[model samples]
Target: MHAGPRPSILFVTDLAYPARGRRYCDEDIFLTSRLREEFDVALCHPRDAAALLDGFDAVVVRNSGPVLHYQEAYDAFCARARERKVPVYNPLTGRGDMAGKQYLVDLSAAKYPVIATVDRAGDLGLLPGAAEYVIKPKLGADSVGLRFVTPDALAAEVGAEPDGSVLVQPRIDFRYEVSFFFIDRDFQYALYAPHPEQRWVLEPYEPTTADLAFARRFVEWNDLAHGIQRVDACRTADGDLLLVELEDLNPYLSLDRVTDEVREAFVARMKTSVRALLH
Candidate 1:
């Protein structure tokens, strides 16, 4: 073992969270085990993160489940980290899903290659002509409260909710979904579910230069200096990629699906990133 002061990290996770199609605990367990080689690590539930972060050099949020489940606690932790100036992995500056789904509406307004999104009834005409629309809470995660409604029923469904509390989008019939994983702005790996019905049955994806360029656009837009990010998108029937979500907050790495060599490389990159944050 190397003799020196290993920085301490309070790794936040929900080891018991019942994430569908994924094992949150096993990924965190594997990550923490590898991280232990370079830092003094402690595991804590998201609820305990705010209270337990004082003594650690940094707080790393991983697989903590959706913040919607514990919004108050997660907000408190974020506020505390900011108030006390404690470094947080993902850096608390992400404008992606970490903030909310508002980015979708904003991106759509700017004509970015994202699924057509609108939160207001008047803007409903902006979306492409589709048989059904997908509506979900602006603060939702893990597909919570997601519903599909026909165009005729769209206004009632959207108007029933508190103004600006939900987002509506035309449900595109995409060919497949793909995700690009990045570490500190550098593309690391990509995975895709060939079958649209089975979103989690991922296979290693060899991204074309054009594909990488498409994914990188958002990464460049986010402008995050460090932290892990997952660019989730769907390939439309017309062979265009549109942003589905930008998961900057504790995106499940799906390490189990990748090769051992790729996993090792990811861990090494993470260790270096953490060290850079400390310095």
Candidate 2:
């Protein structure tokens, strides 16, 4: 190995943002601690990233909370990074939730195994019928502005939504929600919420080949050359997985719930991935 000063990384995060179930600060703290072994790392709030990221070899945006919280600042950071050609860990080319929820509607229309979505209120008939439907802002994240409406009220509620501002889908009665975590194109570990009612109580998941295939389909579809991605899906009563969301930017890694062996492996893979980016 060539000897040189370790690469400096500007780690972007919002440590104080109160996430409902996950500890954004704890995950980022642990990750940075591990990363520090291989690189010179520093933390900065999302709003500060544009100004602070200039001198770093790369920037890793982790648990930075929803960009909507600081849309203008986040946009500026992305623009500046592009102009300066500074490497972003999860490169700015992500087209999944990193962009917005519009991908759900596109994926659904493409006949993918995704929650059926329609952007216009008049298109509710396009989706499979259900007792209730989900209405949420297209730019929303972390369950922000998410709500359920019965079919009777869905039309009116959606009709009230500004054009192209929200998406509507049937409220899936799912078995469990699971997530497949990845670094670049590599699969890391998986986690799932056993109780639908408690979204935060996650357990280690051992994915089957079929499950991996399903998750991989979306990851491959996203086609990012670098960066972390979390493919979130809901297993239905019929045991089929439907895409819930694809979180490519700042997907939380539940490091504590994973075995120490797994956690270390992830860190190692991440270091390899980041190193690959720097190279």
Candidate 3:
């Protein structure tokens, strides 16, 4: 147990958020219940976080849902957090999905094992030839504004984004999707979906050394000194892992799917991370 006065944490979440295939409220409720044992925990919606932050020792963002739904408010919260120098879990400096989808393009350019991404028409050639290509907003989440276009329609689709606000990638033919969860750079657990079309029917995954190495590459590249991160990837037909995304900001913890022992360990690690952040 912590010896000093318990540090107060403003746990930010949207309890009413109706996420498909997951209960945001249940996850946040369970997490906060455990966290309350070690800190002064209070729940607030993301829109209210900036207003409520001044009174807390730190802010813990969990299952707040996609910031796109409340972009203006979320941006304000970020600005306020920066102005106050408030320590936000998953720190705002994260270069992964927290910032935007641009990291996909950056990683692909660096020859990382990520799906090829391009925003401009000229660079579209870099992507492997596929019958259909994916087009998604750079700021999109939860599959928002995602569509598949044929090669004939690609240029028009690319040209339609006058502001260059979208990214394009080849729709990868993959065997399955998997996610690796981490707390403060330590691998906690892994989960995977056996069916490519059914993403949320997750089962506990025991990652091989090669799988761990692949996932760790992005975690290490993200370089977040503290906080939780989820490395999402897909296994190709050729048996290689390709990064799908690195979710650092409010990544949903599918806590319901893991074993009780794994959940306990994750909660313990999170408490340790929060304590480390406070001191």
Candidate 4:
């Protein structure tokens, strides 16, 4: 395309996004540093991607923070990328939380094992009964504006027609949470936080056959071709996993938590995947 050997990439990230319980910048810094070995890489903020993308062979969107903060700019980038046919990592067809939490409602309607979810006032009964339920922006990220409310308060809040701005889910009383990481449909590793309150304190997890099966179902469901994915799940008191969220768009790899060998292998695999996208 550009008559050069190296495949140039515009790595989009927001190094300043104040992500609670996570350092988004640190992860991207580590990744882009490793990626320089195989490509002509440049980093930019999400708001600046559309302007510079035409010069790069591909745009690797990672740790760019929620698109809601810069919807107009992000929309322009997506529009231009598609019009010019610039390859986007994750391929933009992800049907999970990447697109929005709407897929959760869709999956729940189709009877998937995801936590019961609904966005409208009329659909509240579909969710399981609990002493309290969680309400959040349907298009939210990083647990922003999330609240737990009693059923009575929830009913009143739902009745207010609050701009159709939120989603509701039963407060799942799970024992712990686990995440299954994938690279283009291939399982890479699993990690868990033994304590629910300590979400970032992760340890390598060995999943059972059934657990892997459960996680794979969501990965297959999202159907992304080339990108990282993390299947976030919560274990019920009965020791079964329920799908919590499918993070396809810019899913943090948590690379620091893994063994060096695994991390290197992942970086190598990503380089190969990104290189294949040059075609």
Candidate 5:
């Protein structure tokens, strides 16, 4: 508990983090601004979190960039938070991209609706054949270390890399990409990129019953009782939604794309989730 009254919240973010089409700073600024209305919120970079977390009652990790950029420091922060039994907003139970892309491999193996993913070259047979394959580091985010290879080059590319070092998936021809934003297990809103090439130019999406079901499968599969999770999926050419990634760590909400009413509702949901976390 804070010395004063309101539960202090250490909102973790990297304001200067550069992204291709997203403004990392703007989103955090909007969230922290709204969050401050209820709780005592202070902004801190991810690297500084471990040292400063002791001052706050709880820590909320948002848009701190890929852990790949600060692996050692992030590990230390997580270690210290757990060691001190700090109430982290995400509850440290995140098993999606928060942990790594390994969940995709696991989900795919279990016949989940995720894009078929495999680590070893020999396991290529398990994946449905496609003209091209997407290979990326198991521990990657923000399109970092992602690659595309022809079927012939796929074997060499994957084989040259260490097994489990990278993930391989078929580059499906999809109509569009959509992201479902959730506060805890509650659905907030969805946004979709109508153009595949222009992935960041997002617009409001009205999810169908099946679309919501497709997205919910991963959210439920993640097994987290709290935390913001973004289920990013691609609408395949066959009119089916396949999970691209489950972003539970610090999913960029793209609040700027939604209506004010929806955005306000989302912030309210987040505040409620935080209040619940504190109490």
Candidate 6:
């Protein structure tokens, strides 16, 4: 085990970021306040991480927002972290949204019940027949540049760029959306927005054994043994859960929505995971 005080952590975040329907600053403030008790913690934006990371035992990236907005800074941070062998929570090797939207195409091709996706014009034909399609950048976050287009318009709009320039997916007609939260691969409480229009209005959701099993599959696929993750899915008209996104990077915990008991449980679980990472 590495010897030290309970592992000094650099918690990366953007407190002032304006996130629609959610207060990004409020969530980060609450988390840091609790984490301060057991950790030597400092907060910084994603841009400064590369410069400050070498001084900390580990870097906890929380609520950092979309890297697409600050690509150069994010790239430098990842490169420096890898070069220095700095331990980054949620690690730098995540294969889901952390990497890009290419996983959508991969997962869809593998027939994982995900929304059908395509990255190229030639491949648009592969998408299932739908009335409308959603197009967004492959590296997008917070729904930036998302648009709905009829299939006929896609041929002119699809661009050939391998640098994660874009992604095309059918707009799923789902009843509602749910998110399953996890800490270091361990399942935590789940919350769902019963209404389709108000995505941020969440309520406590007790997952059945089958629901837990489905959520666990994605968590296992992610393979992160540290940090937190949120598996987002939509319930289709046919009563099936289809993968919407796997948020492995600074997934907003929505802690204020859960009960006191659930929130305490989550905090306790996070403490255990962070302590384990210290070794």
The model with the greater TM-score, 2 or 6, is 2
Model 4, which residues run further than 4 Å from truth?
Answer: 162-164
1-279: candidate 5 lDDT, tens digit per residue:
589778899999999999888898999999999999999999999999999999889999998999999999999999999998889978788889889989999999999988999999899899898999999999998888999999999888888986578999999999999999887788889999999999999999999888888888788888788889999999999988899999998888899999999999999999999998877
The root-mean-square deviation over C-alpha atoms between each candidate and the true structure, in angstroms, is: 2.0, 2.0, 1.9, 1.3, 0.9, 1.9
Model 2 TM-score, 2 decimals: 0.97
Candidate 6 — which pairs collide? Answer: none
For model 1, how does the per-residue alpha-carbon lDDT over 149-261 read when each residue is reduced to its tens digit? 99899988888874888999998999999999998899999999999999999999999999999899999888888899999999999999999999999999999999999
Please give the lDDT score at residue 88 for candidate 6.
Answer: 86
Candidate 2 minimal-lDDT segment of 10 residues: 1-10
Poorly placed runs, candidate 6 (over 4 Å) = 1-4, 159-164
- Local accuracy of candidate 2 as per-residue lDDT tens digits, 1-279: 224588899999988989997788999999999999999999999999999887888999999999999999999999999998999989999999989989999999899999999999777789998988999999999888999989899888988875879999999999999999999889999999999999879999999999999999999999999889999999998999999999998998888889999999999999999999988
Task: Return the top candidate by TM-score.
Answer: 5
Report the lDDT tens digits of candidate 3 across residue range 120-230: 987888999998999999999999999999999999989888576899999899999999999988999999999988899999999999999999999999999999999
Of the pair 1 and 5, which is ahead by lDDT?
Answer: 1
Candidate 4 worst ten-residue window by lDDT: 156-165
RMSD (CA, Å), candidate 2 to true, equals 2.0
Question: Candidate 4 — number of clashing residue pairs?
Answer: 0
Q: Distance from true position, residue 224, model 5, in Å?
A: 1.3
Please give the TM-score that candidate 4 achieves against the real structure: 0.96
lDDT of each: 0.93, 0.92, 0.93, 0.88, 0.91, 0.87
lDDT of 4: 0.88
